[model samples]
Target: MMRTLFDAELNKLNVDLTKMGHLVEVSIENMIDAFKHQDKTLAKEIMDNDRLINDMERAIESRSFNLILRQQPIASDLRNVTSALKIVTDLERIGDQAADIAEIILNFEGEHAYRTVEHIPTMAKKAKMMVHEAIDAFIKKDLSTAQMVIKMDDEIDSLFQEVKQEVTEILKENSERIDYCIDFLMIAKYLERVGDHAVNICEWLEFNQTGTMNDHRLI
Candidate 1:
């Protein structure tokens, strides 16, 4: 029956999304490790692999649109597909932010440069955790998980501010390390943005489940 075929297509969508989420999760994790360790080789590898995330994004977008055309999903089904469309965009951006941070990590001359900038690793951890939890929420349809991810973003933002302050003070006291401090500041900003993208994905997840737009505060 047509209904059975449509159901199968929806399942396929889930499979593809799970694949995409896993790819992004690994990318963020590897990026953070590279940043913390100042591993240019690993950072370069993550940068090179960023294309995989982009390709998966396009593939999912195409499949989602084709399903919308062929199946004419209504109500909850329509919302589900729409949410997939939105979430993939956020997920893709998260991939980009991770790659960008990896590129910045390569600019550091040594591990000591990383040590000078306090709070960056903590920020990276919190942001990466948000992305991981948001994807898990998507896969499991766990509203509480999604809400928790949203709440977690505040922690990342707070850490970012602390990094900014610490870096500014370091730059003022140690003008010689200006360039390195600037790079760390950029990395912190990227992680903050990554956290925002995770929040966006969680919002879409909430919308997909409830058929109502959650306030940013709620999500």
Candidate 2:
């Protein structure tokens, strides 16, 4: 009976963490959409939505730690709940990074977008997909999927580098557009950090699964 009760609590913790991740994922998607369209209204909406993710993050942290203390979970069970705690922090940080990107969009105010950025949305889409896959992998206990998501980080990084190079070239060719170039580049940097956080959550999930932290999980 005690074991069953412990399992139920752990399951509830996992559910809450995943729900928190989904909310962060939504913020990421909308932030990117707002950036792409230069939509101040949507950007404002994304900034306002950060509170929901923050509240869920705190709740998960409290619950996970409470379970750790009350249950004194065994090795594997300890890993599971502890990982939820760590991953929620990463998720909340990701939400903050996404919000930062939204704020950059807010700065544009119809003046910074020189033409159109074709790569930002694509990079955001891939990064946001990675966040979704990482959360799903944790909830489903699918180590294979988590590994795949970690590997995809390189692609997002590549896109970030590409954006940086393209923006630099544009600024060099046209000194008048330097401000717009800088804004766009800053936005890409935030997106790159978002992808890195996604990778961090994947690593946390893998560590929880194997109770090991070697690079063997890197696909």
Candidate 3:
């Protein structure tokens, strides 16, 4: 009877984590759209919805800790609950960074303010893909998918380097648009960070599976 009850509670925890992941994914998508269109209205909406992500994190955290205290989960079960706690922290940060990007979009000026940086959209898409895959890996408990997401971060980093080079050329041609270029650089940096957070989530998934992180055993 106790085992069944614990499994049911664990399943609910997974459900909540999946729900939070979906929310973060949508925020990233909306942020990309807002940036492409310079839609301050949609940007504001993303920012407003960020609070929902924050609340979800808190709720998940509480549930995870409660599971630990009430159930005294052992070995893999303990890792599962603990990893959910860590994963939610990363998810919350991804939500914040997405909101940060939206805030940047809200600050753009002029009627034709949206600059067409060649690599930003591509970088954003890749980063969003990493986040989506990381969440999917968690849902499926697939280590290969998690490892692939980690490998994808290198592409995101390489694209960020290309954006930096492009930005330098833009500045050389016209220093007057320095502010715009700086904002663009920041957006690229945030996307890179998003890739990083996805990698972190994957690493935690690895830890959950292998009983170690970065080859250091915690269990």
Candidates' C-alpha lDDT: 0.86, 0.82, 0.92
- The digit string of per-residue lDDT tens for model 2 on 1-219 reads 888998998889878887888888889889867876788899888888888889998898888878878876888887888778788888998899888888888888645363466677778888888888988887787888988988999999999988888887877788898778887888788878887888888888788978765566421
| Off by more than 4 A, model 2 | 111-115, 216-219
List pairs with backbone clashes in candidate 2: none
TM-score of each: 0.95, 0.91, 0.95
Model 1, 117-201: lDDT tens digits are 6698788788888998999998999999998999998899899889989988988898998777778888888989999999998
Q: Pick the lDDT winner.
A: 3
Ordered from best to worst TM-score, the candidate numbers read 3, 1, 2
For model 3, the stretches where C-alpha displacement exceeds 4 angstroms are: 111-115
Error of 3 at 45 (Å): 1.0
**Measured by C-alpha RMSD in angstroms, how accurate is candidate 1?**
2.3
